[model samples]
Target: MQSQPVLLTAGPRHELPVTWQLSGHARRLVSVAVAGLLIAVITRRPEFVGLAAPALLLLLPGRGRQPDHLGIEIATPAGQVTEGSQAAVGVRISGQGAGQVRLRLHPGNWISLAGESPGEDGWFNFRFVPGRWGARQLGTLEVVIFDRWRLAACRVLTSLPPVICYPEPARLGSLVVLSKLPARLGEHTSRRPGEGVEFAGVREFVPGDRQRRINWPATTRRGTLQLNTFTAERAQTTVILMDISVDVGAAGRSSADLAVRAAAGTAAAYLAARDRVGLISYGKHLRWIAPAAGRRQAERISYLIAAGAGPPYPLEMLGSLAGDILPPGALVIVFSPLLTLRLIESLRALRERGFAAVVVDVLTAQPGTGHGRYRATADLARRIWRMEQEAIRFSLREIGIPVVHWDGQSALDEPLAPFTRRQVVSR
Candidate 1:
């Protein structure tokens, strides 16, 4: 997606209350100096007159001045940035007068910030680099205020609302097409005689054979009429099922990241191949899109994935969702790092219902060891965890389902290359 300003604000902004405070005991100094001066004059002693200097300056009217109305205008020129890219954040304080002003920006975990402090002119532009994916909101910005005397600070929380940070999809060119094709006109050759570019076997002239398909040479050689046949090219429907049950592995490089990236790439690749695509996201809730084809489908998939970057549903109705929306023989690709018996049952149900299904396993590596002093025990635990993961793989393979791992290091090759669709059996 092209990056644009997710938010922009300029011109006269609503003003914040202008509050002032005493600097270095200014009130005490002034009161003491005046009392001393009166005492000195009444007591006929001018020696204490020097004490009046500290109070006189502070007591002067308007010496510590404040702006009539403090206002801030923030403009995020590149308010929307792709993940792992940088943009500029522009901040201009309107009522910046005297003293010193510093922008106290609390950047979110999804961004790394660095920039020079705003000067007396109150204009600060900084580079904002986005880290992880999502429409992450920008952090809060607080303006630290210091009077001319350099004592007593008043923090004015300006109105620089959080803007969305768009996360770009990973580079996905193609997918290993192995699912069974339904009867439709598309790019994929069905290999049966219908309408397509590739030629199949030939036969003697049939009742419905077109004159253009007749092989003149073959007809003359055979001393009879002959006709040509070609395989039918058809589009396939691919459904991307995102299982946001949980995130695993390390922070920043978690399984959720891998799943989301892979899902996006897979959708893009399928769409490019002229395949009908749809999405079913199960993250705390089930959201779905029926089979469709077009640029709008890709955009909808991206938005759905970004919006569902959260925990999965507490219930186990993912199978129901799949059964309702998926047609027979549609390739169902599930992107997830989570595995449960309920999910396994769902997969079994899909296969039972004649759906072509595969699992894109997002968790590539093992989890980190726990923090403890029991070294031998930790080693044993790691071994057991690996065994459990191996069991999951074994079970999936038993059901004729292939689990492809996305390491997030390179493009995911044809995961379904070595696999075939399971034959549907009637109960």
Candidate 2:
């Protein structure tokens, strides 16, 4: 999605009192005045008093007045933003006799300003890219307003709205065509013969066959009438089941993060193919979007994908996903690290229920044994973990579920290429 500003600047808040203080420049002026007076007393120089008089006059009471009204507005976009994309945050200062506006912005994790600070016109036009996904606060904005003579200043703290950053789907130009399509109008060419543009095969000319479908070459070779048959174009349901049970790996490169990005890519590919796509974030709780198709559905799925970047959800026991949540004959594409046995059992349940499925392993690396006291113990435990992971993959394959490993270093298309060659077979 193209990036745009999604938030409006706030209006002036007169009720919020602004407490002004002597600015550093003002404090320096006082020191200058005191030094000049002391030098004049010691040397009896009248010219020193002349220099200190202006400094003392400027420091007199009521020389600098407090701002009558002060307001700070953040004009940055706050809605959905794509990961790795730059966002422009604009802060505007508005009020009568508003002092020189200076902002101290506290940037969030993986979020940094492109430049040093906001420009002279009270606009923070620097671009910042969010390294991670989810609803994240850009940071707190501390606005300091200074008087005309730079003698006094007041601070107004404003919390910037959390931006919902959406993970950009991988560049997947291909779609995984299902072996069987539901009996509904869509983009995929079904195996069943019906009305479509793609040719299925040649068949004996029937009474109801159209003359346009007649194959003259086949008829001439066989000395009998034959006609071309076309398969029906139909849509299928695709459910993206993501396992957020355990997140492994680094902050931005975690298994859960990779899975969310992959799921988004898969959903986009299927939805572009005119297939009904649904999402199920099976972790702390079952958050799902029923099978549907449209631009809105894409937005809904993207929003849900952003939610996966949050802190780990509380552990929830998994028995099995509800049957009603999954459409009959729907394709279940599981994006998981396969960290839990319960998730494996869930996939088993899916296969038993006759759902065609594929597992995209998002585990990028094995847990490492660092140079520590428990290095040997950790290595042994790592070996055990590898065995468990392999056993899980083997067991799933045994149950007719194809498990594909996505190391995240290469394009997802490489691992998913095999699925595109053939349709997923439901057990």
**Backbone clash numbers for all candidates listed:** 4, 1
Task: Write the residue-wise lDDT of candidate 1 on 1-427 in tens digits.
Answer: 3443333334445677767666555667767898889888988788777778666765665465576567777766433355677675667766657767767778777788745333234557656677777765677778776666655455776545554554456566545454356777788767568889888878899786699999889999999999988988878888888776677767667777777777777888889888889887766567777778889887777777776543444446666554446866678888877455666778877766666677878886575666678767888899998888888878876876777776777766645444423322212
lDDT tens per residue, model 2, 226-318: 999999999988999988778889887889888888888889988998899998887766677878999899988898888653333333323
Best candidate, TM-score: 2
- Supply candidate 2's per-residue lDDT for 136: 80
Candidate 2 off by > 4 Å: 1-15, 35-51, 58-62, 96-98, 116-124, 308-319, 370-373
Off by over 4 Å in 1: 1-15, 21-68, 73-80, 95-104, 114-125, 144-154, 163-168, 201-228, 309-314, 322-324, 367-373, 414-427
Report how far off residue 341 is in candidate 1 (Å).
Answer: 3.0
